[model samples]
Target chain A: MEQYEKIYLYKRIVKAKLFIDDHYAENIDLGNICDQANFSRFHFIRLFKSIYGSTPNNYLIKTRMEKAKILLAKGHSVLETSIMVGFDSPTSFAGMFKRIAGQTPSSFQKKQHAQKNAMQLNPLLFVPNCFAENNGWTK
Target chain B: MITKITHTCIYVLDQNSAYDFYVNKLGFKVHTDAPMGEGARWLTVTPPEQPELEITLFLVAEGGMFDEETVQIMTTLIKKGTFGAAVFTCKDLLATYEELKSKGVVFKKPPTKEFYGYEALFLDDSGNWFSLAQINS
Candidate 1:
């Protein structure tokens, strides 16, 4: 496994996490993920957990579920939503959904849509460019 | 000699959302989208002005870092949203804060005095924390 001071190693782990985020929906597997972070299959898992506190699969599942919720709210059918998130079967998606989201996909989607009105930032919000003025030149 | 830190990573449930948040909202430039065999993607980010430097984001679940046991632990923290932090050097901390706030970036804490200089904290869409600071040149 690669070694750096804790700080330097952490920065590398972060870089890997970013890669996962950009392509989670695109059929990711373990070997490729480990390679991206420049770690072996054995070591990458431990270091990634130490740094980001989650296994790669869980992150991928959660990401898929999150997207599933959004698609459901948009009125996509349960089966469609299931496939959209990469689950081959709606049953599998439902089972996973129950485990993670605590409710059936349809129910969650119904509840979400029932909310009074959708605000521009209702689902989620990002930190605005509050630091633009201070952002200095790149190193 | 090693150059300054070029890239940083943040775990995300899905990469598309991460891309939207970082590129669309945070205004980071996408530096790399290399392919790792087996359907995985390698993504990176950098300040718009410094396109050459890139930070890669890896997708690891709670205990999935190295194997199943670890994935359990790591996924928990990642789901709860407490993992790591990204530090950005700023020329003027105050101005950056105001600009980010205007763009709808949420801040956990306002800028405050620190040994390094003025600093502020914010969270990305993935619940990863980041710091913005103005350091002496």
Candidate 2:
């Protein structure tokens, strides 16, 4: 019985993760998440928490923020990146970024540039790999 | 027409750790490490000469498409080291199983003959369930 519960829990976790990875940039709600994992809302929440230390809401935010950071680094504007990550309003997006990342989008981009500069300062950071040798994207 | 698979993406917290498991432990070859955006790394790999299909290594953070609850589940599973799974085609399933065993790869089940070929289950470093299949030639 306990083993079955364990397996059930495992499957739900996998499903939930899949839902997040696939739809992290969309408008997601608790009911939708539960439905995607094929679990009751109450059971899904409990099992999710038991397996993952954080709540579902926190995970979504983190995933979006991480994506935003990447997009920002890639030269996308704050508004563009915000919309790309499914934020309804730029203000809300900025607020969330400030809270979670401790900076606004512009500041984060600045930091990224600084970090890139520092990496360039270290010659060993740019060691050319044979696999990426011909790929235009890496260069 | 049965076209080749281009890529499959796996989200992870640590890129280097995942790379170690896929490349060093599982014997996959690193095919490319393209810069994705900002701090994100787009590391890809293939099996031997099978460079046509590559796996994308993605790093997960907070927000975006997933609500707080969904991220919690994925993060939890990833932390517990039981995230996802893959199927790798091998030249010799039985021999490969033995070799993986020598490398301390644990198996939940032994290889058995299926209509398609020989199949066996092994957990990746993060507890992703993957099967090794080698067709009888």
Candidate 3:
């Protein structure tokens, strides 16, 4: 391929990716994403997979799952997190979360909560032993 | 008070490839190349015009600030072109684009007139894209 043509192809793929990034929460479809890149649906799917090593739909799911992990870690409820991340239903969300995160949403949140609680209980973990000793700690 | 930004990072897949891309292709001057322990090196470069700011070509690996899971996620994200880290400005957009293209740099967008100015998008060796723009004066 010519240099300019290659650049053009790369740019179209970049555009499709940017569209996915910006509008993942919306109900995006293959046709819409292909339109952003100005490529036919069939051609876009093959081109995207060739470049990114994943289908566009899989990329979107990954994006949503990443966002859902952040939200769940921040203490969002499963239903709310599901809706916020564009999952159609909480059941599907929990299943997909387990598949990707190796646990359910609630389980992940519990782990994060336990870590937070442990950190809170051991406030001295934030302070250096030398500083504690200088400040008049015996042991 | 925070005065000026000194250093920023662009995560790359490999340091040697990044070195060739940034130094040999982009024509950036190497600011520091020192051992940083644990098989890592502190590699930084500065643009030709912007010597004050150093861009660290940080390698994405399973180590400091990145656990194994985080490294996996970052690797996937980087390969998918999820990061658009920074914008670089050149004196002449078309000339710079041509120059970089000749050096085997892969640009995603050629110099085109945008609403803001003349801009182009290019990918580094690691798939992180950057906007090369010359703002309207």
Candidate 4:
């Protein structure tokens, strides 16, 4: 009985997380997330952190940042990537990206483009810049 | 010396659900999905990066190796989470844990540092749990 209820709660929490993942591009907030799990904000935050190792808000930002990184790597403009990742303004997105990703979106995008060209130049080598550095393929 | 092992078996209550959980959710690749004799499905999935090893998803029905009584016992045990099937490793345990948790995988334990390494326990669709680990390199 107790175990069955526990599994049910877990399923609800997972559903909420998946909701955030699928709707990260939309204008969703913590209330929308907690509603999916049928829990109040405080309880949801505790359970979510316990299960996922990060609070729901933090998880949402991480997801958004991850998506922004992908968009920027694909040569999207910083403003465009910010909007696509659900940031209200490019300036705020730039600030948050720097805090979370440790570099401005524009600088990261530039680095990615350079890395792409470098990889193409060494077509046969076929390794990421970090991997190449670790392997001493680059000095 | 023995070269390498090719296959491992995990007894699942339902092959269809296992297929969904392993292939769809966990992102494993289906190596084989042919039907076996007597309504049994011979499904096997390989981890995305490790294509050489096939994990066989065996159905725990009252056919082939299992009789009716055995099937009943097995079903009870599996639902009760009696099996610790295997330990699966990843490059980053915490990231993988979060990813899998979001994919609806029910975790029995969160990631923790143990004497061997950092590991978390998660249940499959059929209640079979596995230890997900990230060993120090």
Q: lDDT scores for all predictions?
A: 0.66, 0.71, 0.79, 0.81
lDDT of 3 by residue, B1-137 (tens): 98988878899999999999998778687765645445766677999668888898878887555689988999999989999989998755765676577667889898998997899999999999999998886
Ranking by lDDT: 4, 3, 2, 1
Question: What C-alpha lDDT, on a 0 to 100 scale, does residue B38 get in candidate 3?
Answer: 56
Candidate 2 global lDDT: 0.71
Quality class of the docking in candidate 1, CAPRI style: incorrect
Per-residue lDDT of candidate 2, residues A1-139 (tens digit): 9956755556556567557756988999777788877888777777666545467777778778978987888789999999989799999999999999899999999887776665445422332343233322244
- Per-residue alpha-carbon lDDT of candidate 1 for residues A1-139, written as tens digits (9 for 90 to 100): 3433643555456556656666765667887677787888878888766544578767777768867876887789999888877787899999999899899998898786664133222311111122111221111
lDDT tens per residue, model 3, A1-139: 6967867777677678767877987888888899998998889999888766689999898878877876876789999999998878899989998998799899999987775565445534433344335333224
User: Against the hidden reference, what TM-scores do the models get?
Assistant: 0.45, 0.48, 0.50, 0.53
Task: List where candidate 1 sits over 4 angstroms from the true fold.
Answer: A1-8, A116-139, B1-137
TM-scores of chain A, one for each prediction:
0.71, 0.80, 0.82, 0.88
lDDT of 4 by residue, A1-139 (tens): 9956866777778788889888999999999999999998999999898867789999999989978977897799998998999989999999999999899899999998876675446532432344235323354
Write out the backbone clash pairs for model 4.
none
After superposing candidate 4 on the true structure, give the runs of residues whose Cα lies further than 4 Å from its correct spot: A127-139, B1-137
Listed models, DockQ each:
0.03, 0.04, 0.03, 0.04
Name the candidate that leads on TM-score.
Answer: 4
> What are the RMSDs of all candidates, in order?
20.1, 17.5, 16.9, 12.7
